[model samples]
Target: MIEFKNVVKKYDNNITATNNISVKIKPGEFVYVVGPSGAGKSTFIKMMYREEAPTSGSIIVNEYALENIKSREIPFLRRELGIVFQDFKLLPRLTVFENIAYALQVIEKTPEEVEQRVSRVLDLVGLSAKRDNFPAELSGGEQQRVAIARAIANEPSILIADEPTGNLDPETAEGIMEILEQVNKQGTTVVMATHNSFIVNEYKHRVLEINGGKIIRDEEEGVYSNEDANA
Candidate 1:
């Protein structure tokens, strides 16, 4: 579960990325965040993951208040959340298995435990065959799947995907969505940020639309509702 209370994020020169935004996401729910460019969608996701601190207001994720979370405690907070991004942030030299295993290794997990967890998540993302491959060898979709596997390897309670399918073709994007849906079905709360209207229309779910740094609309089973012709 995630909750934001009167959250505000401002960059230098008084530019507000998020303006007094407040929202809540319940456990076992899947939600889509929709917005135009510069509408604060990225800032919102960063707040949830503690990548960007709110200038004001409070953020509570998986029961820990992040507004004032100590730097030393951030690792513990992140242990309970999974994060995926538009760019597949995989290390070029690391094999797919090693890439996923590195997350556990950082937390000082035993070698045996790391191997077991990496194996399970790679299987979950259907990338078992590519375990020894590097990121450059895989297709775009395959690379993203590997990224998802790495994120979920630790079994985080919440998953935050920021424009996860932004680089893939429609068919490949659909495949990634299926994996996310399956993950959500298995009880991990999923919050995804995307601008793809086709995917939005195809996989209808709760949508929160942001505009001008504020929540413009919140709808259950909603489609992309941007009024701009170019959107």
Candidate 2:
């Protein structure tokens, strides 16, 4: 579960990425954070994952209060959170298996454990056949599947994604969306920030709309569009 209380983030340029945002996401719930570019969606996700600190207020992710958490304790907090990015962020030279395994390895998982977990996640994402392929060798959607597999390799309690399907064609993006839905069904909380109206309208879920650095709407089984996001 995640909760934010009057959170604020202001950069040196005096641009406030997020301001007075408060919301809660329970375990196993799927929510979409929809907004146009520069609407603070990225900063909201970053704060949840501790990539950026809030300028004020509190953020709690699965019971860890991020306001005063030491830098050394971030890894432990991240152990319970999985992050996916728009870029796929895969190492060009590493094979699918290695890419996922590296995540487990970072947490000191043994080789045997790593191998088993990686194998399971690859199959989960329907990428078992591409285990030996590198990022460059795969199609965009396939590469994103590998990235998803890598993120869930640790069995994190929550999955946080930023523009997860931003790069793929609509059909390919739909495929990625299916995988994310499947993952959410299996009980991992999913928080995604997206601008794709088709996907948002088609796949009903909780929607939180942000603009001018604050959340203005939260609705269940919500529908969203870029135009509506600017309101």
What are the runs in model 1 whose C-alpha is more than 4 Å off? 225-231
lDDT of each: 0.91, 0.92
Off by over 4 Å in 2: 229-231
lDDT of 1 by residue, 1-231 (tens): 799999999998888999999999999989999899888999999999899999999999978899999999898999988999889899999999999999999989999999999998888889899999999999999999999999998888899999999999999999999999999999999999998888788998899988888998888988784463145
Sliding window of 10 residues with minimal summed lDDT for model 1: 222-231
By summed lDDT, which 10 consecutive residues of candidate 2 come out lowest?
Answer: 222-231
Model 2, CA-based lDDT? 0.92
Residue 81 in model 1: lDDT: 89
Best by lDDT: 2
lDDT of 2 by residue, 158-205 (tens): 999998999999999999999999999999999999999899898889
Candidate that would win on TM-score: 2
